[model samples]
Target: MRLSVIAKVLALPVVFFVCFFLVPLSVVLMSSLWVQNQLSFEHYLTILLDQYHWSVIWVTIKLGIYSTLICALLGYPLAWFMIRIVSTPLWRRLLVILLIVPLFTSNIVRSFGWMVLLGRTGFINETLQNMGLIERPIRFLGTELGILIGLVYILLPFMVISVGASISRIDRSLEYASRDLGAGHWETFRYISLPLTLPGLAAGSIMVFALSVSAYVTPALLSGGRVTVLPMLIYQQYSTVFNFSYGGALSIVLLLATLFLVAFANRLGSTKGGDK
Candidate 1:
């Protein structure tokens, strides 16, 4: 009876996935296979065999991995500070609001803001010049570094919230016991807190990676058409060239890459959980 109830509860979500995600993905998969108004392997071969396509794939993977790693490194400390160091409820609420407000804004707005800030004569370069950091303005716009900065800033809040929630749910008694046992602050964190927050870290990393892989607006604005990623190619195929078959191929490849990454993360997460 309990199993039946569980199945009933899951029925709606399963149907929703089928109708929305699975159906659309199936269409793309079929379209990708259709070449020259007939079924063929030509589209897939073109994407896989092209050197430019390979370079774009490499760039996309590199950016996604770097962005995720940086977010985790920075976010975990911020999350810990929020949950542990910040004792005032009002301050915590305000900090959370500040973190989340950017998300409520449009991606275009956020990307444009970065573009201004990172431009050659932008405030960053101006301040650096004033402070004797450099003799001339350094180019940030249309650079990989600029894109990384934007992507990391946009994805950080998700990491902070995920890890913060996990840290909050952890029992304080465990930490107290570790302290009572003469463990230093670092030791307590390394042995007790860090291990406990692994699940949240895993979840946030996966979320950041997936979003980074598919990110278009931020990369488009930040890259200034200098650097091309897989999504950009896909967009060009569909929008400029009007090649739906080739676009569908690129789309399926991106989707498959994301799925492969998520599955790998899940497997690693399961292994870690089992070890515990």
Candidate 2:
């Protein structure tokens, strides 16, 4: 009776996952493998043999790597500023609210905001011109730079929050100990603070990287079709081509690539920590 009651309590989430997550995934897997009632890898083979497909996949991965690295470089300082530098709770709360407000808004709205800011006649170009930085409005829209900017903006808050939480949880005594050891600020940060924050950094990197890889709207809206990516290709196959098999194969490829990178990063992190 105890076991039965326990299983019944756990049943709700299991059933929910099965009905929602597993069921839809199973449907897609079946469609991808099934053709004329026989299982096949033909759809996957089609994608594997295509150069255009490989190029898009590479672009997506490259964009993700660049975005994540930039977010970390920028976010670390911002996290440090929020945690160590900010003394007042009100300002910190306000800054956190500002960060979250952008996240709460839809991607379409954020991409649209970038669309306005990155245009040839946009605010960025106008400011550069006024400062005599350029004779002409540099082309940002429908370019890789524009897409990257949008991706970074959309993904940065994740890094900040992750690192911030980690920073907040850090024992202040650790810093005091390092300082009392006659360590310089850079030495303290390099040796003591940074190593402790690695977990949060890794978590943030994975989150940003995965999201950047699968992002469609930012790339689609910013690229203006000049650039192509795996997610956009998947969208095209599903929406315009209506080829569920090919779309499923593409989706699987993206999923696998993301999983592989995340696993590698996690393993690398663990190894580094263990060695330390």
Candidate 3:
């Protein structure tokens, strides 16, 4: 009877997942495989064998890695400061509000904001020129660096929140005990805090990486048609070229690649945890 009740409780979510995610994904897979009403691997072959496609894939993966690494570097420090150093609840709350406010804004709006700032005559360039940083305004628009900046800005909050939550859950007594045992500040953090926070770090990194790879709007606006990524290619295939088969193949490739990378990250995190 309890098993029956448990199954009933799970029924809604199971049904929702099947109806929404699995069914649509299966349809896409079928579409990718079906060309001229016959099953074929042509679309996948084209994507895999083409040097241009490989370059786009590499660019997509590169951006994801850069964005994830930047977010992790910036987020971990900010999270540590918030959780470990901040003594005032009011100030902490204010900081959190500032972090979250941008998330509530539309991605298109935010991307457009970056477009203005990263443009040649934009605030960043003007300020740099004023400060004698450069003789000429650097070209940020239509470049990988511009896209990276936008992705990092958009994704930074996820990392900070994840790491901050983990840091907050860590017991202060553990650090105190480490210090009592003659561990220095860095030693205490390395032995206790860092290990304890690894799960959150991994989770945040995976989240940021996945989002970065799948991102369309920020890259689209910042790239200025000069740079191309897999998502942009997929969009072009479906919308402009009217090639659903190729688009579906691209989507599946991205989905599979992201899943593999996320699994690798999870495994690495687990191995590190075990070693610690």
Give the candidate number with the greatest lDDT.
Answer: 3
**RMSD (Å) per prediction:** 1.8, 1.6, 0.9
Per-candidate Cα lDDT values, in order, are 0.92, 0.93, 0.94
Q: Per-residue alpha-carbon lDDT of model 2 for 1-276, expressed as tens digits?
A: 999999999999999999999999888888888866789999888878988888999999999999999999999899989988999999999999998999889999999998999999999999999999999999998888899999999999999999999888889899899999999999998998898898898899999999999999999999999999899999999999998888988888899999999999888888887898
Query: Which is better, 1 or 3, measured by lDDT?
Result: 3
The order by descending TM-score is 3, 2, 1
- The lDDT, on a scale of 0 to 1, for candidate 3 is 0.94
lDDT ranking, high to low: 3, 2, 1
Q: Candidate 1: count the clashes.
A: 0
Give the runs in model 1 whose Cα sits over 4 Å from its true position: 1-8, 268-276
Instruction: Give the lDDT of residue 246 in candidate 3.
Output: 84
Mind giving the per-residue lDDT tens digits that candidate 1 earns over 216-260? 999999999998988998999999999888999999889888899
lDDT of 3 at 124: 99
40-112: candidate 3 lDDT, tens digit per residue: 9999998888999999999999999999999999999999998778899999999999999999999999999
Model 3 Cα shift for residue 79 (angstroms): 0.7
